[model samples]
Target: MPSSHTSSTSRAPWRRHPRATVLGTLAAVVSALALVLALPGATSAAPSSPQAPQPNPPQPVKPGEAWMGAGVQMHEGDSTDGSVPDEGRRNLVASVHGVDVSSHQGNVSWSTLWNSGVRFAYVKATEATSYKNPYFTQQYNGSYNVGMIRGAYHFAVPSSSSGAAQARYFANNGGGWSKDGKTLPGVLDIEYNPYGSTCYGKSNSAMVSWVRDFVNTYKSLTGRDTVIYTTTNWWKQCTGNSGAFGSSNPLWIARYASSVGELPAGWGFHTFWQYTSSGPTVGDHNLFNGSMDRLKVLANGG
Candidate 1:
């Protein structure tokens, strides 16, 4: 909750616009200011379909080659259609197929994520009891205008002075969790932070109490179970995989991998898995999270 916002000068260029300002939680909003930057002229200039030019031969991209238009950042792979075939991308772990995004990553066009095969997304909303995130503004406001099922997650500060207080802070921020039953439910991010010692605490009981309290209160209030976000090490040392409030409250396991095949065995019931760091995108902004196929399943109440 203590100013997760980064300095504006360091952000990506896709964020600074009236259109990008449509975020929900304050944490998300602040993230927008810090995480994503606005390119001076990121707007699209390519001629629509018929007006576009024919394909050109492969040009070796020299070091530091930059794109031309505003907001025009990274380039798509071959197949000007914007699709990333399995051959070009790094292979992924089997379980981890989703992506976890903070405001730092810029605008995600639904079409790009959809076309490339994103399953689900856990958009950061509230953090601890006080910080509100601004990263979700675009997605909450309009990116879904193209239709993608999304869920919300609260950065858990179980080590807060009052665990219940932190839970209420998160619940109150978004007028309670989204009960659409289509979007993924709330998630409690229980990570270690050298500066966030108070948020997560240094002991196991404290962390467990913090996670349980938040999950319990959120479920009671929203009529939906809350998920836990943690790494394998944190699970063993801090959380202990003691089990959630019930079967409804699943685990969103985050384990970075060169490929999903690299993930180790046996943690607990994983409702969704985050497999990659960078995936496809609609505009210049890089989509930070997982696939659309998984997203639809979670959306369909699977």
Candidate 2:
């Protein structure tokens, strides 16, 4: 989950001339005195009754905004009191519904998920040169058995390991692809680093090189382009808005807002949109950018 910390700065009142400041203070005092005098005196002066507490003002709502809680960020539409309407779900900006999961979701009920209208799934396969999801086998195979298109993703650790090494490890473990129409291409989950610095303390060019290495290695192993999963902020900050992989790799964008907003450089459109992390489904809610037929073509290595 991404941190939603926001900071605000207050500027000191400008007083180029001291006389202006004194005049402003005098005016404020006069207004305060007038307001005080306008209020009526307490009638009869009996035992004063306690005043009722005023209700707090409603907070402003942002369309497609998400609240962070319970170690996950839940979109407003996916909240318990605010579900995406059936019409909205059926007619989402992106048509096909899906989900992405990891060991964090524990043992998932793939059948229940399929029944709930999940057409595809991306399961976490590996992180860096180590850390394979313990439940990868069950989650990967289970989704496929339940008739959902399945794919695997690697959590990128550009700071600690060479991208090629990590890619090789991921492919060997679960990121490999086949001509089978049910399997989607492997994904590279590269976003905010969960470890240390946001950019993994690397220069923008280094980050781009790292990503290219990962994609190249994965492609060599699978004979299919790796899907690049990222957020707009991360793409700009870490990769310097490079679109080197845009032509070859499909994009899986994460945005919890109502609108997709501006995408990274290179890609004119996104293939996958992860709209919410805590949805009715047991993982991140997503949408394939097209119809089932297009998704099928992608799965078939088109």
The best candidate in terms of TM-score? 2
**Residues 1-302, candidate 2, lDDT per residue (tens digit)?**
00111011111222433645534443443333223212212111212331111122113212111111111231123332223334224334335667676654445666655655567888878777767766677778988999989999887778888999999999999999988899998988887754457788999999999998999988889898888888887789888999787778888877765655788998877788776554312345566766676788789877
Q: Which candidate's lDDT is highest?
A: 2
lDDT of 1 at 55: 23
Full-model lDDT, candidate 2: 0.64
Candidate 1 per-residue C-alpha lDDT over 1-302 given as tens digits, one digit per residue, 9 for 90 to 100: 00111112322333332322222222242233222222211222322221111123124322111111100112212223222223113212121223344443344444444443443455556655555654456544333454545666666545444657766776676525453544656666655442323224446666667766777777677665666555555566565545543344555544434322221124223444442223212122122222334444445434
Candidate 1 segments whose C-alpha is farther than 4 A from its true place: 1-97, 175-181, 194-199, 244-248, 258-267, 278-302
lDDT for each of the candidates?
A: 0.41, 0.64
Off by over 4 Å in 2: 1-94, 279-282
Enumerate clash totals for all models, in the order shown.
37, 0
